[model samples]
Target: MNKRLQLFSEWLQEQHISLAFITSSPNVFYLSGFYCDPHERLLALLVFPDEEPALICPQMETARARQAGWTYEIIDYGDADNPWQLLERHMRAKNIKLDRIAVEKSHLSLERYEQLQACFQARSWLNAEEKLRQLRMIKEEKEIAILRQAAELADFAVEVGVNAIAEGKTELDIIAEIEYEMKKKGVREMSFATMVLAGENTANPHGVPGLTTIRKGDFVLFDLGVIVDGYCSDITRTVIFKSATEEQKLIYDTVLRAQLAAIEACKPGVEIGSVDRAARSIIEQAGYGPYFTHRVGHGLGIELHEYPSMNAANAMPLERGMTFTIEPGIYVPSVGGVRIEDDVFITDNGAGILTKYPKELIIVS
Candidate 1:
């Protein structure tokens, strides 16, 4: 068994979990090297305490799984095959008790849950999501290296977007240039839909990019990410077009200071909520607390948004090897918005920032 599967198996053994049916693509790829997006198709990894792990995927992806380094039994199902029936047969062949079967509580749909129940009729169902999240919360050295590469590409992507900015250019125009440059760099995918909001559009958090043209004295927000070797890097930088008024400068400076404080508070042994609080305090003191809508940030990894969320209510302590984002923003309808985000990795002493795009407010003429 691979190290990740071995570790998961040991956990199952310790918890007395009979079998773990991991369904999510992220968890499956984390445990097994194989990564596939079987849209509307059944895909999973079955991990047992005393038997070899098995991968279930579409028949077309069997070779891809092998190429991705999965050396175990692959139960490839064809379109006409009933995957639930095949899974039942495979588990029964092992002659193991299915007393306490674990499933991903968050990812398993109601229909799948019913199918699982009909398959083995286990005595109890356990939530496997928490264990999987805990397992993937910390970054391995290899994963960190890939994340660094992803962050570098993200930085370059932002640079491309920043350079592509111009008066009368639409938000979609800059996004096209940014994505074109990323494609040239061999990036097959982005962590999420690229967001390039300009002028009044920036005031809306999670704004959608459209034909909104950039104009002088407008805040242009570039929120984008790049995927490298299956890992992801997210970054958000806001810059003024041509000139910045005094009010805009104040809002931008406040967000930058808040983001820096939050990043500075990221140290091992510190409470995770403290980081959010550190940032929120600055924004609140500046009277833009309500303007900051979402949580400070979220964990980042194979999935764009992964484990421990950075919010003021989460009491989890910061740990070395944990990676997340520290983004603090102020979005005012009339004044526009400013968000400075960075991908941060917690270290033994302090934090290591992965995305290195300049945070200082920029005047793009």
Candidate 2:
């Protein structure tokens, strides 16, 4: 078995799970190396107790699965009817008789779960959501390389967005320029919708870019990411169109200091909560505690959001090879918001900032 599959098998052993059915698109892609078409009827990746992984896909997708170069069994189901029979046959052939089969509760629909239960008469079924998430928390070197490359592309895209931020340019125009740059730089698509908020619009954490024109002295927030090599990079930067006001400078500086403090606190063996607290404390001390509404950051790998979340409530320990974002922001209503985010990778010595873009507040004219 490959290193990733070996690691996942070991994790399953640790969790005492005999078999698991990975249904989520990201999880399926991670294990089997097959990116399923979203329009496909039903695609599943099954991991047995002590056997190679198997992919249960439609006949039309068999070619795509084969192209993944996966060294495993491909159980292709015809498109016409009785597709579920193919899954049953594969399970029977592998002799995967388990009382408690693990499934992703978040992604698997109730109807599909019922159908699965009806097809396979198992002793019991259980939700193994955390089990799979835990496996993906500490990334391997291969995953990290892809993530770093994605971050590099994101850094370039942000540079384009920053340069496009000027007086009289609409927020949508700036977003278009950023997307154009990402495409020109070889990024096939964005991880999520690019966010370009100007002035008071920045106060909304998930603000939508509209027809509002960029104005001088307004704080412009650009939260963007790109999908490169199936991995994702998320970054946020707040810049002023012209000169920064006293309040804007203070808020921007506070967020920068907080982000730096959080990044500095990241290291192997530390609790993820500490990293969040380190940044939250800075913002709270600066009297913008409530303004910093969201969590400090979240894990980033194949999916934009993953495990080992850096939040006040999470107690997962940070380990070497784990990658996440350190984003701290302060949103002031009727004025604007300031957020400075960067991707960090945990190392044996300390945290390494994967994002190379300038974190310092940029004043554009």
Candidate 3:
């Protein structure tokens, strides 16, 4: 059995929980070393307090799961078969009684929860999300190695996106070029949708890439990430297609200053909120507080967004081995927007920046 799963089983025994059902893709990957998005299909890892754990997956995924280091029993179910019934049979065969069961309330759908409830009588549902979060917060050596390479690839992606910027180019065109280049380099998937917002569209924080053409003097933003060895990376960079106006330069400089300040404050024993304040204060002092919407950063590892959100109200202290992104931006409607992001890991000494793309203002033709 995997060491992480062994620890989870011990935790289950301590909580007096009969079983733990992990369904989220990241959580399942963390426990089983198997990574796959089931889409609407049923995929779950059931861990018992005393008995062995079982992976309930589609019949086609059984062999794949085993090859991915899942040595425990895997209950394979067909499309015509009811997975819940099959799960019950497996537990019954092991003489395991369902009483106090733990579930990922945040990840499990209410419809599925109802189905699970119908199958168990006199069972209590406990939240396993917090425990899972705690288990994943501290990065192991192996996980950090993967993240280091993931961040390097993210930097390479930014380079590709910036170089692809030119007059008469659409946002979609740049996105296609960047993704195509990454794919050719062996990147199988992106962490999330690749974004290439141009001109005023960059003002929108989460704007989608479209047919908006890249014009001279327009600010072009590239926000994207890729998955490497089950780990993910996120980075954002904004550049001017031609020469930047005085106003555009001010906005870009302000954002870069704020982002660097926040990353510099990333050290052990500092509260998470302080890091956000370090960036937000810079933007506010520059008279762009209202325009700087959204948090300063978010945890990044197996998933783009993980735990220890760097927000104004979160008081969690920074700890060693914690990986996250430090991103700060200033968006002014009708003017343009600028964002500078880098992946950093908390170390005993200070922040160890993984992404090393240049932060200086770059002008593209």
Count clashing residue pairs per candidate: 0, 1, 0
TM-score, model 2 to reference: 0.95
Local accuracy of candidate 3 as per-residue lDDT tens digits, 1-365: 77888889999999999889899989999999998787788999999888888898999888889899888888998889999999777777887778898999988999999888877753689999998898898899888889989888989988999988888889999999999999999999999999999999999999988999999999999899999999999989999987889999999999999998998899999999999999999999999999999999899889999987989899999999999999999999998889999988998989998888899999886
- Model 2 ranges off by over 4 Å: 10-18, 94-96
> Of the candidates numbered 1 and 3, which has the greater TM-score value?
1
Alpha carbon lDDT at 14, candidate 3: 98
Give the lowest summed-lDDT range of ten residues in model 3: 114-123
Q: Where's the lowest-lDDT run of ten residues in candidate 2?
A: 31-40
Report lDDT (CA) for all predictions.
0.93, 0.85, 0.90
Report RMSD for candidate 2.
Answer: 1.7
| Candidate 1: tens digits of C-alpha lDDT, residues 168-226 | 99999999999998999999999999999999899998999999999999999999998
Q: Quick one: ranking by lDDT, best first?
A: 1, 3, 2
Q: List residue ranges in candidate 1 displaced over 4 A.
A: none
Please provide, for model 2 over 1-365, each residue's C-alpha lDDT reduced to its tens digit, 9 standing for 90 to 100. Answer: 76666777777677667778888888888777778764648888888667778887788888878888766787776768565778877777867666667899888888888888887866777777776677788888888888889999888888898888878999999999989877777778899999999989999998989999998899889898888778899999888888888999899999999999999999887888888999999999999999999999999988998877889888877899888999988999998898888989988989988889998778986
Clashing pairs in 1: none
Q: Candidate 3, after superposition: displacement of residue 18 in Å?
A: 0.8
User: 1 or 2: which has the higher TM-score?
Assistant: 1
Error of 2 at 176 (Å): 1.0
